[model samples]
Target chain A: MSDKHMSSQFDADLNLVSSKVLEMGGLVEAQITRAMHALNDFDIEIADQVIAAEETLNTMEITIDEECSNIIARRQPAARDLRLLLAISKTITNLERAGDEADKIAKRVKRLAEDGSSRTVNIAEIKLSGEMAATILRRALDAFARLDTVAAAQIVRDDKAIDEEFRAFVRKLVTYMMEDPRTISAGLEYLFIAKAIERIGDHAKNIAEFIIYIVKGTDVRHKSRDALEREALS
Target chain B: MSDKHMSSQFDADLNLVSSKVLEMGGLVEAQITRAMHALNDFDIEIADQVIAAEETLNTMEITIDEECSNIIARRQPAARDLRLLLAISKTITNLERAGDEADKIAKRVKRLAEDGSSRTVNIAEIKLSGEMAATILRRALDAFARLDTVAAAQIVRDDKAIDEEFRAFVRKLVTYMMEDPRTISAGLEYLFIAKAIERIGDHAKNIAEFIIYIVKGTDVRHKSRDALEREALS
Candidate 1:
């Protein structure tokens, strides 16, 4: 084959892999939504569906990772192409873990259903945070597909809102548990659910950070928000 | 350069990266230990040290990751060498996050110290679990250094013990909070700390899983314990 032909072929391969990542991201987003629905309505079937989907998500991660390795070996991609492959590898890991967080929420909802306790503690904050996490995750995936560092930086900043909401929710749960001892067990379960949602938001933020790194060749992880924004925008 | 000389140079590069990984692992292990001691004794000085060390850990992760990418770009490593580089990239991520968990423990300890609430609930179980987590993390790093799948599989199994300890401790804490509302605030703090330690164990298990993958060319993550053991031994 001509050199031009080989280069285009490599580009095609990269495109294919990028598409698979988006497909996986979409499925993960769906899992979070279904898990949250199960939690809000105490719906067992939806929870079970989310639980069963975990295996599929895990398999997708391994498959995509192997594909990345194969491409690197065959093409010997360098520079920006190499960095994009590396970022994809890391992005899929975050997506897989986000799926796991959804699975965790589903399992907790199932347990809460089994206990047959009336939902005394209000979980409105948790439900709202779950939606926020799912929304941020969707936006992050969009930013990744478009390679939009501006949007990615915005997602990074948006993650802090979810954290604040989580802290406020935890405080409210503590107050409820203290005022009424009977609500302690249920409140703890809600706390874990809220934590799962917060982690989902974090995973989304991680994907956004990878976008900045892929585009700017500057890693924004573990940096202050201001520094990350400057790097992503610069 | 001759082919043989080039191959030896590549080997030296891999060795250097591997040793750096171990050095980072050692520092992360110390972070966990110091954070736990700070938690146990409510010592602000040690807690401050753990928090301060986080910047160093973050920098090490980025530097090591960059080194991995550079090796891939320069060496165009194939098959096992490529796999090792990819695994190193992922392993450093887990190590860095484990360091984050330690920082979390330290920050929580600082908060608890400021609150000045008498330790009403016995956290002996949490303390024991923290030790177990640290020991397993050390073992996992050793397994990685030696490429010992047998030891890696054992670390995977041992992680279950820490999870059980966490569950038992949470159950006990729930009862305590129900009995005495005054302990509710401090109990929640301990709960978060216990959760952080559990996450450390999870990260260690992830590193062990990567080691198994590097050696056996199989992905053991999200697999059943029996399946993982059989693959590791086989």
Candidate 2:
């Protein structure tokens, strides 16, 4: 094949792999959204569906990783292409882990459903926080697809707000538990769900970091938000 | 340079990178061990130390990742060497996350220390489980260093035991919190600590999976424990 033909073929392969990563990201987003809804409404069916879909997420992770490995071996892609491949492989793991966090939330909901507790604790704050977490994740994935470092950096900054919301929700739950020990079980479940959402936010931040790295070849992980934003702009 | 010398240089570089990964693993193990001790004794100093060491762990992770990228670019390592680089990079991330879990445990300890609650709950189970988690992590890293798939598989199996212990601990803590709402704050802290230890075990399992992939060239993640055991035995 001619050089131009080979380059175009490689681009096609890269595009295919990128599309698969996006597909996996979409599924993970659904898992988070469904799991949160399950918690909010005490829907066992949605929770069970999230649990069932975990296997599919796991399969997607393995397939994407294998495809990355194959491309690396076959193409020996250099510099930017290589960095993107590395980022994609790492991003999938984070996405699958975010799915695992969602699955954890679903499992808690499943237990709550089995208990059949009629005591409706106020989860409004949790609901709002969960939405924020999901939005951050969706926006992070969007930044990744577009390689938008500015947007990625902004999402990384957004994680702090989610974390603050999580802490506030936990404090409120603690007060509620103190007021009525009867709510402890359900309250504990909500705490875990809140934590799961916080972790999802962290995974989204990780994806954002990957985007920054891919775009600028800078390792922005573990850096302060201030520094990251400056670097993203630079 | 001759082919022999070039091959030797590549081997040296790989060894250096692998050793760095092991070093990072050692720091993570220390973090877990110290965090557990701090939780058991309410040693604020040890907790502070763990918190302080987190920066070093983060730095190590970034350095090791960069080294892996450099090796891939310079050596263009193929097949087994390539797989090892990928696994090392991933394993370091898991180790760093496990370190983060330890840091979370330490931060909780810091809060508990300030609260000055004189009530001593039965944390023996949690301590044992934490030790088990640390042991599994150490073994997983050793397996990676030696490429021992059998040891990795055993570590993977061992994670279930930690999960069982975590669940039992949480149930007991929940009972304590319900029996005496006064213990709710500390009890919740213990719950978070237990969850962190459980997550550390998960990171160990992830490392074990990487080791298995490095050895057997098969993705064992998302499979049933029974299936994983069968594959191990096979």
Candidate 3:
């Protein structure tokens, strides 16, 4: 192939790579949302679906990573392409971590379903978690697709809300456990679910960081995502 | 100057640069440890000390970055020296993030000193956090001083410990607030402090990743740090 043809081919491959990453991001985002939904309603079937989805998300990450490495090695991309590859690489890490958190939630749901906690914890506790997970997952995916650093940075505050929800969930669970000794095992496992959901929020923030890095070539991990969001939105 | 004389002079400058980075790492390590203590006791004075130390850490990071940049411009090092410069560059990023986490913890401490909780919520909480921070801090500094990937990889377990502590602390704080509405504000702030410390542990992990990169010339952030530890150590 001519040089121009080869350049177009590489660009096409890079585009393919980006779409795959975003696709993986979408899968992870959906997996967490489904897992959250499953946890809230004790829908073992939905939870199982999320569990099965984990393998897909994991494989997509590996695929996208391989593609990125191939492009870097063969195409020797510079500047923006380099940023894109690096961001995608980091996004894989974030997405994989998110998938892990989703799996944990799914496993917690399975245990909770088996343990039969219908009469123990209130639905309000679980719903809050599901809602927060859904919101963050959507924002994380949105940021990735748009390469929207500002939107991604602002998504960090969503974590604060998720943290609040987890905080409230744990409090309610612990109180129920303390009040009724019968609720202890269920409550401990329930708190684990809440922790997993919180982790999903963290990984979502990690996704947002990938978006920021891709768009702005800046890494804002461990920075105040709230501050980053404010700056981006402004 | 002759080639040999110029090379020695360059080495002298590079030594100064490295020494500053190590010095900065020492300060960052101490700040992390001290922040944990301040959080444990709500020691305003210790928090103040940490706050004061931030300037030194910032200066260290900036000076090292500049020196590295200057060395690259002037000497254009390769192989071992190149690795060292790269390590120094990445280490500066991690150390800066570490300092930020420490600063956050210190700020949380100051708030805790004034309006936050002085009564210990749970001893397990403090013990777990202190141990995690102390372990990661030690390993990261060891990685830099000895260029030991084995030592650096050890920070991964400590990071896991930090994550566990953080999750548990959030649960405990939530439990505390749930038991009584009065504990809400205090529990929330302490939650943020726990979060900051958890982030400090993450920065340490990032440093460990950089160490792996330097030692092996491969980016291994997403790999399991435990197996890496075994490989690097043996």
Candidate 4:
């Protein structure tokens, strides 16, 4: 192949891999949404569906990762192209783990459905946090697709809000459990569900960080919020 | 440089990267050990030490990841060498997260110490699980260094034991909290500590699976135990 032809082919290959990542992100977002719905309504069917979809997400992760390795071996991409491939490799792992968190939520919903003890312990905050996590995750995927560091920096800042919400929910759950031992069993379940949502937010933040890394060639993970924002925005 | 000289230089680079991984692994293992000791003894000093060490681990992860990228861009290593570098990159991420988990344990220990409540809720099982997690993590790193698929498979199998121990501990905690509401707050802390240990074991299992992938050229993650063992041993 001519040099120009090979360069275009490499670009095409990169685009293909990028699209696959977006497709996987879409499926994972659906899983999170369905899992939250299952929790809210105790819908065993939706929970089962979410559980079943996890295998597909796992397969997608493995496939995308393999594609990245193949591209690295064949193209020997350097500089920005190489960084993009490495970032994608890491990004998909975060997505798969986020999907695992969604599965955890679905499994807990199934357990709650089986128990059939619908008690009102006020899970409003947990549900809100779940929504926020999902929204942030969607935004992260969008930023990744566009390589938008500005949006990614915003995500790094937004993760703290989810963490705050989780702490608030945990405190409330503890009070509920202390007030009524009957709620302790179910309260613990809620705690885990809230934790899963928080983890989803974390995975989203991780994806956002990877975007900044890809765009700027800077590792922003493990950096303070201020440092990360400056690196991503500057 | 001659081709042989270039190959030897590449080998040295690979060895340097591997040793850095092992060095990082050693620090993480120590962090886990100290975090557990702090939890068991309510030693705030030890907890502080663990928390302080986390920044070093974070830096190590970023440094090692950058080295992998540099090697990829410069050497364009193919096949096994490429896989080894990628695996090392992924493995350091897991090790760093495991270090984060240990930091979490330390922070919780600090909180418990501040609360000054030495309640006698049976945490022997949690302690045992912590020890198991650390041991498995150590062995997993060893397996990675040697590319020992047999040991890696065994670590994957052993992760189940940690999960069972976590379940047993949670069950016991729930009973304690139900029987006496006074232990609810402390019980929840112990629950989180146990969870951190379980997650550590999970990170170890992931590292082991990577070792299998590197040695066997097969993706064993998200596979059934039977399938993983067959691939690893065959």
Candidate 5:
């Protein structure tokens, strides 16, 4: 009940929360990579495993979130500390979404197997999308762990590249569909997979923003309002 | 400084931020609806018109985002205010993306005009996609402005529907491509546009989360993280 005791306990609790978030972040990264591998290899073994792994990732998200919430409520953290906790909470959504998108990738792999098509695209296309996603997941987590706002800002940019690559592949897949109606169904499934991968990149970017939210303790919303006001002023 | 001066200033600033977000939100909705109209009518005129309007939407995005950042820095909002500001910032990203997706719809129409093609799937698919996007955007923005957790939660389900609809279209588009390899290029382009629209849905879902962040003051990351963890645990 002493003030000194209370302060130390609070400090320990904060450390525990950070460690928990980092732990979950690692799991999310692994899941994203596994899902990407499943996509590239169309390895059902991996696909099934990734699909199954999502449950663990989901559970971690919940536990970590609850822990953070309980701390905020109990400790009533303010200013920088509060921002850090809030960031942890928001980042988990991004992590879990990345996981869900991975599930979609796994689902596509399972479907691709079911379709029984041997034909493959450049694989480069799929690989490019997958790599972009993997990069974002990795960078976002690193920036988050470090509380590196600079790095996180850079990470969101990577999404633009992934997007460009995904868009190009979609165009190619559609062309393939036009070239041979027979390949349309098979190609379309892969296209869906690619779309999911692109989404992983987006979720990663959202995760990166949390770093900015935490370190700067600034809301990014002003970026939007400024633009709107300018229009009205004009 | 007098308390009266401080309180009045806060009111003035809050009004400025909120109004700007609402302004941008309205344009986002209109642009998306117009793009849908272009597709439904296969009306090149409307499509061309949509293309013309894109600059407006894009400009708004940049301006609104900047305003949000400025406001956040000045106000230093916490908890609900912080969430609202952050949500406003993020909402613009979604709106801009939705605009980008809509712009694609316009571009596709232009392509149709240039290529001199007729209806491949009629207007039903386009109409359906457009309507879904419009609905999601409206609901997402509304949830944000009102900070209505229940409404925001509903947007997530709506997003799932959008995903389902998009998947159906991909299948149909694939069928068309298989029937004619020559049509693959154009068919794929259309499908790519559809994917962008689906992405817009995802962004709206994200904005809905922002609403939850504002209302519950609990980071929703765990909402997703727990799901993954449960999957992992199970």
Candidate 6:
């Protein structure tokens, strides 16, 4: 193949991989929302849907991983191309973990629903935080798709809000458990769900870091959000 | 340099990076043990040590990551060499998160110690699970170091025991909280610690999967332990 043709072929392969990642991201984003809704409305159908979708998420991860490995083995891509493949592989893992978190939430919600305790507590804050997590997740995927490090940094900043919401839910649930021993079972369930949402936010932040890394070739992980922002923008 | 000399140079660099990862793994193993000890003995000093060591863990991760990136950029390693770099990069992230989980456990232990709640429960089972998690972690790193797929598969099997232990702790804690509302605060603390330990086991399992991927070039994650055992043996 001519050099130009080979470069275009690599681009086409890269685009195919990027689109697969986006598809997985979209599925995961929907999974979070549906999980939250299932918890909020005691909808077992949505809960089961999320559970069923977990397999698809796993398959997508494996496919994308294989594609990345194939690209590296065949193209021997260097520098920026190599970095992009690395970022995609890492981000997909995070996205799949986020999907797992969503599955956890859905499973717990299913149990709560079955036990008839799903609506026992005021889950308004939990629902709100779940929405925020999903939103940040979608935005992170967007930032990744666009290679927009600044927007990725913004998603990192947004995770703090979801974390605060998680803490607030924890405090509220703890208070409820303390006030009434009878509520302890339901409270613990809520605690796990809230914690899952918090983890989803962390996964989103991880994906955001991969975005910045792909764009700037810097490992922004383990850094403060402020540091990430400054580094990504500068 | 001759091709022979260049190949040896790459091998030396690879060995150096592997040793660094093993060093980080050892520290993380000790962190898990000490965190459990702090929780068991209510040892604030040990808890503080684990908390302080988290920064070093982060630094080691960054160092290993930089080494892999430099090797990739300079050598443009292909096929197995490239796969090794990819696996090392991913495994270090898992190790760093495992370190984070240990730090979380230690922090919770410190708080519980301050409240004089660490001794409220027997905690023998929790300590046992922590030991199992650390053992599996050490073995996973060893597998990666030696490219032992069977040992990695065995670590995956071992994690099941830790998960069962975690569930047992959860059941016991829930009963305690239900029987006495006053124990809710301390119970929640233990819950978080047990959850952290369980998550540490998960990170170990993740590392094991990476080792398998590096050895066999197959993604064995999200599969049953039985399937992984079969694949690793095959």
What fraction of the correct interface contacts does each predicted structure contain? Answer: 0.95, 0.73, 0.00, 0.92, 0.41, 0.70
Q: Which stretches of candidate 3 lie over 4 Å from their true place?
A: A1-6, A43-76, A114-119, A123-126, A148-192, A195-199, A202-206, A209-213, A216-234, B1-27, B48-117, B120-125, B153-206, B217-230
Tell me what TM-score chain B of candidate 5 gets against the true chain B: 0.86
By TM-score rank, best first, the candidates go 4, 1, 2, 6, 5, 3
- Which 10-residue window of candidate 4 chain A scores lowest in summed lDDT? A1-10
Q: Could you give candidate 2's per-residue lDDT for residues B146-219 as a string of tens digits?
A: 88878888998899999999989988888998888999988888888889999999999999988777766788
Pitting candidate 5 against candidate 6, the one with the higher TM-score is: 6
For model 4 the TM-score comes to 0.97
DockQ of each: 0.88, 0.78, 0.10, 0.90, 0.23, 0.67
Candidate 2 residue-wise lDDT, A1-234, digit = tens: 012334787988888999899999999999999998898778999999999999999999999999998988888877778888898999999999999999999998889889976245788878898899889999998898888999999999899999999889888988999999999988888888889899999999999999989988889999999999998999
Candidate 4 lDDT tens digits, A28-142: 9999999999988999999999999999999999999999999999999887788899999999999999999999999988987798665557899989999999999999999
Model 2, position A181: C-alpha lDDT score: 92
Please give, for residues B109-223, the per-residue lDDT of candidate 5 as tens digits: 6777677664554445646776887888898877666666677777776787888888788767666655656666666657766777887888888777666666666546436
Minimal lDDT window, size 10, model 3 chain A: A1-10
Could you give candidate 5's per-residue lDDT for residues A162-226 as a string of tens digits?
A: 98988888767765655556666777777778878887888887777666666665545223434
Which 10 consecutive positions of candidate 6 chain B have the poorest summed lDDT? B1-10
Worst 10 residues of 2 chain B by lDDT: B1-10
Clash tally, candidates in order = 0, 0, 1, 0, 49, 0
Whole-model lDDT values for every prediction: 0.92, 0.88, 0.70, 0.92, 0.70, 0.87
DockQ, cand. 4? 0.90
| lDDT tens digits by residue: candidate 1, A1-234 | 012435788979988999999999999999999999999999989999999999999999999999999999999988778888999999999999999999999999999999986388899899999999999999999999999999999999999999999999999988998889999998899999999999999999999999998888888898899999999878
lDDT of 3 by residue, B125-158 (tens): 7557766776777678777767777777777656
**Model 1 Cα displacement at A119 (Å)?**
1.3
Error of model 1, residue B42, in angstroms: 1.2
User: Model 6: share of native contacts present?
Assistant: 0.70
| lDDT of model 6 at position B7 | 73
Global Cα lDDT for candidate 1: 0.92
